[model samples]
Target: SPRFIALCPTTLSSSSSSGAVDEEEQRLRSDLRERFLRTLLLMTDKQVEFNMHEKVRVRARFGASDIDVLNFQVSGLETPLGVQKEALLRCQDVISCSFEL
Candidate 1:
């Protein structure tokens, strides 16, 4: 196995130590979270397609997601055997999900 070695400094120096950095970080996090929540709200009752690892894919009607975003509650989940009335899908199992904007 070949390993690459760093030839330069790997860290950058920062001088700003005020609370401004914390405030800005919080603001950005809040804004991003708000956008994500709005997207979830809009996706409710709409069809969504999920792509999982190992080339597995599924389609379901969006219902809701947990606060931690660890799981999603969906309805009419299509499986290989049949459609499930309702199901909870682990977020970690999903590689990506998509819906019409």
Candidate 2:
């Protein structure tokens, strides 16, 4: 018991360690969110290609996305059957998406 107590971290040290970890996690989250927002801004009105499951691919003009990333709003969507003026594509159906510079 004495050896275990000596090996265990003190309350203050443990709290500091937890605080450092939380700070690091917050920093990473903020960085990622900023980058994603920038990417969305750059993608506005640009031509984007969406690759979906079952080998289905489509091209559309980037409009916007919901805050939760659940759906994407696109314009001039080109599909196999026909073209859609505007449509909302569910993120769940998409495998990947890309755009050119």
Candidate 3:
């Protein structure tokens, strides 16, 4: 699916949005959440999602500033009953990169 191709985290972060933290990161994160929900939609009879909370931990590059992101949806799909193996990778703090989206 075309959307699946857009699922590439790096691509979405670098190409789809502007900047790393403000746009790229957030868009990519939300996209992943939506994809997960879409899959669940195909499985369950009714809508079965209320929110999506993702805890992202990032390290500092050259300095001593860390980006620890605590993302949670106030209103959305309900959290899945059990979270077993989550395929998630946290992108550490922005160090010395000039990525202007």
- The list of candidate 3 runs beyond 4 A from truth reads 1-20, 46-101
Prediction 1 TM-score vs. true = 0.80
Q: Over the stretch 1-101, how does candidate 2's per-residue lDDT look in tens digits?
A: 65445544453356565877666766786899899989988998999999998899999999999866789999999999999999999999999999999
Ten-residue stretch with the least lDDT total in model 2: 3-12
Tens-place lDDT digits, model 1, residues 1-101: 11112311221122245566656765786899899999899999989999998898999999999877899999999987899999999999999999996
**Local lDDT at 50 for model 1:** 94
Which residue pairs show backbone clashes in model 2?
A: none
TM-score of 2: 0.80
Best by lDDT: 2
Can you give the TM-score per candidate against the true fold? 0.80, 0.80, 0.25
Ranking by TM-score: 2, 1, 3
Candidate 2 segments whose C-alpha is farther than 4 A from its true place: 1-17
